[model samples]
Target: MVTQTPAWVLNDQQGIESLQLADNPVSTPKDDEVLVKVHAASLNYRDIVIAKGEPQLPFFTPGVTPCSDGSGTVTAVGSKVKSFKAGDRVCTHLVSGLSSSSAPTFTDINSGLGQHLDGTLRKHAIFHESALVPMPPSLSFLEACTLTCSGLTAWNALFGLDGLVPGEGTTVLVQGTGGVSIAALQFAIAAGSTVIATTSTEAKAERLRSLGAHHVINYRTSRDWGDVAKSLTHGRGVDIVVDVGGLSTLPQSFKAVRTNGLIAVTGLLGHAEDQAAVPTILECLINACTARGILLGTRDQFHAMNRFIEDKGIKPVVDEEVFDFLEAKEAYRYLEQQKHFSKVCIQLE
Candidate 1:
């Protein structure tokens, strides 16, 4: 029988302000469930949005266990569980529902472990064995923790949608230095594409360049960033634009991509504060570009991406600031500032 444990719960609808830590019983595995002793976890912008509360909480765990991606050790498994045993180091996929052994259909509300059910902010969690993947031996717990969300999302954009090929010399334009952007930049560079990364400040521009960006654009200085992007491409524009800032940066992004280029919409960054406009769509069509909405990728894609990162020794770009599990709220605040170049993580003991 699984014992009780303590977990952090979102106290109320004031968003991050509502997070409250409390003790709750740890659930035992029913059939294929595995009990995980979570060691590390990372936050995403989606977690922040849910913490703030919404009427339609599409797919996430409720209350205070807010983060989606985490890594841990398997301590116990249900009678029917296979593929994992005690002492296995593992990370879970974003859509826990898809991990169901019966091949989940559309009805599972808690398809994602952390979103609709309690997530890894707690010391222990009960997840289906299908939700788990062995942690890459090459990656530390923190680095592996990023895979389930941003890492997978980046993987989907490059390989799934764009069909990125190594040594292709195609140009990949990544927006800003957030988790997805940095992940995309890393993958693009590894795939032998020329990377053009945009940042709001000179400091971040320097960092982006240091991380293998072939060129860095300070969108702050170059107000007409699309023209600059086009100029940098020698007026050809880029082949792929990792469009993270959906509506706000949409117009500029449209102008930067090449004819037949692939634009993967990965995030909003407050750009989707309002709905996207028709002109943006019109312009993209005029350029003959392909636009796709990217979500966290599939399990097959996750393994593929992991193999790539592991083989290449590509470490995730992480923030210098580290937070203990108790300081989860402060970590969210830091993420909100948009100052972090990569992922903001909370370390659990």
Candidate 2:
């Protein structure tokens, strides 16, 4: 007997309104794959950009599902599957076929789940056993769903081979209170680093401080917040800067980082016009700082991050407004508004 699953597809020809629910036939897992009953999925800014058919993110095919982050229970495993069983709870990795070499590009076949292949925004999805990790027992499905993209991106920025790898007494600057930034804040704190967080409002700044931020900067009130961040560290500047704002904020990150510091360029939330500016590259060279572009991490990094989260008892800060699976479009709209403090999750069951 065949099985059917409900999913949302992005059709470039139809625009945002065309993203409607459709029923898809669930394929049997190949010898190295596993079938998952996806229970929860999370939203990211990239989803909104993709839904709007942005020219830069041309990875979506007409009928492809749209999200990379999800958590579920394993319903079946193929003959060759060794790590997971039918009853195990699991979360997916954003990219597959990643090893220590990391030689394959993002365009490689099966490299990115939501981009290069079908994603996890469905009731049931099949993935290679190697691309899935056991969910941390301390988290719910909604929270676990967030790990695949935003969480992993933060983890990779801080701990990957080219990452910052903060330790005791290290000072790190994180921008805003979004999922990745908040995850970075928590991870830095757990690693015994001093966190300097930036937010747009005082209320949000206070909230960030409550979440173990050693210092909070209101970027709105202080346009030259980078210099102010440097002042707070007594002119030495921070050891690492997690720059999610891309070009618009990169200038400030350049000012805030210490000489020989590491800056992880992770997102492009700033304006397009600002992105074209070339001076930021010169600034990085002038400051003698290393700026690395971070992608989602490998399976080994994902497993290690989970162990850290478990050991530290860290909880992912999910937004209060949880949407049902049928309200997937609404979830996207909410994320587009960018008002949510952390993760916006869609519950499937």
Which predicted model would earn the best TM-score? 2
- Model 1, stretches more than 4 Å misplaced? 54-64, 99-111, 162-167, 272-280
* 208-282: candidate 2 lDDT, tens digit per residue: 988999999888899889999999899999998998988688888989999999999888888634545534567
- Tens-place lDDT per residue, model 1, 120-149, is 888888887767888888888888888878
lDDT of 2: 0.84
Q: Which stretches of candidate 2 lie over 4 Å from their true place?
A: 13-15, 100-104, 108-111, 162-164, 272-278
Q: Report residue 139 deviation for candidate 1 (angstroms).
A: 0.8
Query: Which predicted model would earn the best lDDT?
Result: 2
